[model samples]
Target: MGDIERALQTFHSMRVSAIMPPIFSMPIVAEDSPIVDVLKLLKTRHHVWVVNNKDEMRLEGLIRYMDVMNVLLPPEHTKARLGNISSLFKSILGGAEKASDVMERNVLVIEEDATVLDALKKMKRYKVQILAIVDENGRLVGEVSLRMLIDEFLRLMKLGGAQWTQHGSSSRSESH
Candidate 1:
């Protein structure tokens, strides 16, 4: 079989947890943390998860780089500009103190037990690149990113004896 097909089969057989990084590696902040902290974390990470506390670490909201950028920019630069002039002024004037003030509460999440394909589908459907991995009690566990999937695919392709040219088409070795 071709390398791409073999990679697809491997993905189907794997679960998201197999490729996700542990929660300890993920950037996390308390819901009441200062917005400045969230921005600082986002400066180094793609996204940050806001939790109720550091102990329980229940997922409360999420803050992506775009999320913080949108909040800091003028209201006209974002979609909710109709009556957000006050909001813009407030954000600029330090009215937004906590992470929850600017975080997206409707975060897209996937259970750790979900298949890699399922995670991909959810990400595609929500038009997101990252997903928070949760446990049965909705506790923050780990995270998966589009980059992770791509890395896994490339690793599998190499292991399957497939070589890609500059043009992007792959070839399989006949040394078997």
Candidate 2:
């Protein structure tokens, strides 16, 4: 009936397809891609990169920031010490020599038709900040970030607040 109510309804019905923004970076590769290259792609562009093993780009898995960080920071006394930039570089170069070595095969993805609330819940449950928005064909279309959600929510709040102020002023004038 009012702006706030309309906003709430819109939020409840918003599908990932409608709210998801364009994909930031698509660093995709086959199974045999070098891990070092993948790491470079992730570092320079995306926090997560998708991988496909078959002919079709089926949702295989995601490589995350933590995975790359782990390779960069190896266990103590293995060969090199921590805090050494050279050692860190060597470790990353050594371990992630191959993409399969460092890639996180377990990836979480969301469908286009899923509600924004569903995406929020999934992100909260996984403690992740971003989710890949995919279609039924398993093709990545866009992404949804927490910042985007917060911005949209704040915009709705402002709209609702303005509507309430106008309604209050009108009611006061009528009473007078």
Candidate 3:
């Protein structure tokens, strides 16, 4: 098979676990954690996963940097509903205290057993760069990122003896 074909095949056949980052590397905060803590984590990462306080393994929600920004500084075009205004003031006045108060409750996730191709498709469909990986019991495990997928694809191509060039074509193939 050609290099591209081989890469595609590998992506389709390989499970998400093959590319998922270690669970400990993921920033996780309890739902009851102060929003300040989430913000602290967001300083170095795009988002933080929120888990149930009573059961840390269970996935609860996620807080993205944009989520905090939106709550604290709503878009100018946004209509000032009473609730929306209240949330903004609360956030500014320290009333919006916990991660759950500002988290996006419906976080997109992928099963750990899913294929890399499945993860790519889900990420594309959801227009997201990362996905929280869950096990069969729906416990938070780790994460798979678009960058990881790209790196894995490049590694697969190299293993297939294909050297990609700036022109987007294989310059040469190494002999087995």
Q: Give the top-scoring candidate (lDDT).
A: 1
* Candidate 3 structure quality by residue, lDDT tens digits, 109-164: 99998998899899999999999999887789988889999899888877777776
Which regions of candidate 2 deviate over 4 angstroms? 24-31, 44-46, 53-55, 75-95, 157-176
Instruction: List TM-scores for all candidates, in order.
Output: 0.84, 0.65, 0.83
Instruction: Estimate, for each residue in 1-176, the C-alpha lDDT of model 1 and write its tens digit.
Output: 66767777897768999998867788999999988888888888878899999999899988887666666876555455686543453253446778887777889999999998998899999899999999999999999899999998878887888887787666876774
- Largest TM-score belongs to which candidate? 1
State the RMSD for candidate 2. Answer: 7.0
Q: What C-alpha lDDT, on a 0 to 100 scale, does residue 89 get in candidate 3?
A: 39
True-structure lDDT of candidate 1:
0.82
The Cα local distance difference test for each model comes to 0.82, 0.65, 0.80
